[model samples]
Target: MGEFNLPVKQGYGENQKTSCIKCVLWGKVAEAYAPNIKKGDLLVVSGEFYVEEWVSDSGKRLQPTIIVNQIQLAKKSGDKQGQAAPTQPKATEPPVDFDNDLNIPF
Candidate 1:
């Protein structure tokens, strides 16, 4: 599995500003629906909408940036579409090539 870099956000008391790394995993597909992603460790990204928001200080002014969602991993393969949440392996297993490189003389 590839490495996923997630942002960390903290809330400032009494501040109405949205100081959080809000992101959506999935909302269009039926199997996947994540309206608001919060600060948690349950983010299992598999073709999931990966986004991060941060403030950049430019010339003594705070600039807010909104990045589009990124799919870290593509949709998993299965009997049906949108089946990446499950942990079951593929139905058909490919043959192993452990000894394929061995050259035996007759």
Candidate 2:
């Protein structure tokens, strides 16, 4: 089993506050789902939320966690499966003179 911190947003616009929630991914689900998740990528996660309380030598601690049942990458409104997301154009000029700009005068 592996753990991940998911950032949650509260409210909207200027009132938005972000918080990290602990999530646990395990077994075949983790192996398959983890790879596709990228940093800052939106995800749709469904699971059970629980808190674990324990007493240690010094004090008591409570840990909040989500036992993940399903995880999927959240797609933009126009995104379609098996199709590449639209990318911005890399400059308005042609690529023929690209090497000339990188000659580095060194």
lDDT of 1 by residue, 1-106 (tens): 1132345445677753444333322222211222223333334333323333455564343323222223223235453675555342232322222234222231
lDDT of 1 at 95: 21
What C-alpha lDDT do the candidate models reach, one value each?
Answer: 0.32, 0.63
**Backbone steric clashes in candidate 1, count:** 0
Error of 2 at 56 (Å): 7.0
Candidate 1: which stretches are off by over 4 Å? 1-19, 25-31, 35-41, 45-106
Q: What is the lDDT of residue 71 in candidate 1?
A: 27
Lowest-sum lDDT 10-residue window in model 1: 24-33
Model 2, 1-106: lDDT tens digits are: 5678999889999999987778876655565566666787667777768887899998998877776666656655556664444332223322222133333121
Q: What ranges in model 2 sit over 4 Å off?
A: 54-61, 76-106
- Which of the numbered candidates is closest to the native, going by highest TM-score? 2
Query: Each prediction's TM-score against the native?
Result: 0.20, 0.59
